[model samples]
Target: MGSLFEELEAREATARKRVEALEAEVAEVSGRLSAAREGLERLRIARETVAEVLAEMTPEKPGVAVDTDRSSAVDSVASAYAGAERHVIGVLTVPNWQPGMGAEVLPRVYRDILEVVTDARGPVRAKQIVPRIGLPAEAGKIEGTRSKLKRLVERGWLDEDTPGMFTPARRRGGASPNSR
Candidate 1:
């Protein structure tokens, strides 16, 4: 009986040691996992910063000189593309039945629209703008949005570099046409 009691004591000691070792291993693994997560977060932030810098560094189309008067328009376009990448798309809303109001009102709406487009990260279509600005979805069906976008291009608030690809003017001074 004494020998049996001794054996049981030895077994309990071994089991306790095993539990302690397992606890230590668990703590080490948890620390490693936390470190890895922190590293991943840092990488994600770095990637986003790099992407924004690259986008800003990219130049507009070659052989097309952007008008100096359209500097605000160009800035708006770049801002929009960057904003879109960050997932903050806004709409340009105008009061109903106020088209004939005044030049002041017109500039306000244009500024609002420009703000939305400039802050977006990608090319925003007229259809998307209507919904974002709190206008009826049918605004796209009407000729109004289309005409407004065209006017924006004419006024140098937006630039239609290609048939469907609209970008801001190249007045903010990042890359030159020769570099693109």
Candidate 2:
């Protein structure tokens, strides 16, 4: 009986040590995951910044090649391709609204946002629009949504009459171009 008790105690100690090792591993993995997510977010922001800068500098003519000295020609080519197939593909930033432009030309998140504002039929705030677009009603998400709304306003896809309140930009026909 004494020997059996000692064996059981030894087994329990081994199991506890394994659990502690697993816990340590989980902590290490969680830290790595957080770092990876942060790096990914930084990359996303860098990409968006580059896209915005390129869009501003790019000429409307298709034959004009972007200056490859400042940036990769592949990005310019991809942007041109994206512009050509924008109605079918998603763009990283909102394009300058054209007369016949529709919500389909925008990315899925932007389209969802536009739809939410149009459906609201009045000015809506970022917090109000966030959950409607299937985002969690968190401060970070609300701020991100707000930034997107401001981008839409800048691109003439939406309007902000009051600070923090967004509405679809009005067309000559009293309907939003996004409605089409």
TM-score per candidate:
0.34, 0.67
Model 2 residue 13 CA deviation in Å: 1.0
Q: Name the lDDT value of residue 141 in candidate 2.
A: 78
Tens-place lDDT per residue, model 2, 1-180, is 999999999999999999999999999999999999999988886766655554444456562244423345455556556666422112234666777778897878899999999999679999999999898898987987998888798777998878999887876664445432
What tens digits encode model 1's per-residue C-alpha lDDT throughout 1-180? Answer: 999999999999999999999999999999999999989978875764443343233236331223323454345445646645453211122211221333343445455566667777977777766666666778423244555565566544567666655555443344222122
Top candidate by lDDT: 2
Worst 10 residues of 1 by lDDT: 88-97
lDDT to native, each model = 0.54, 0.75
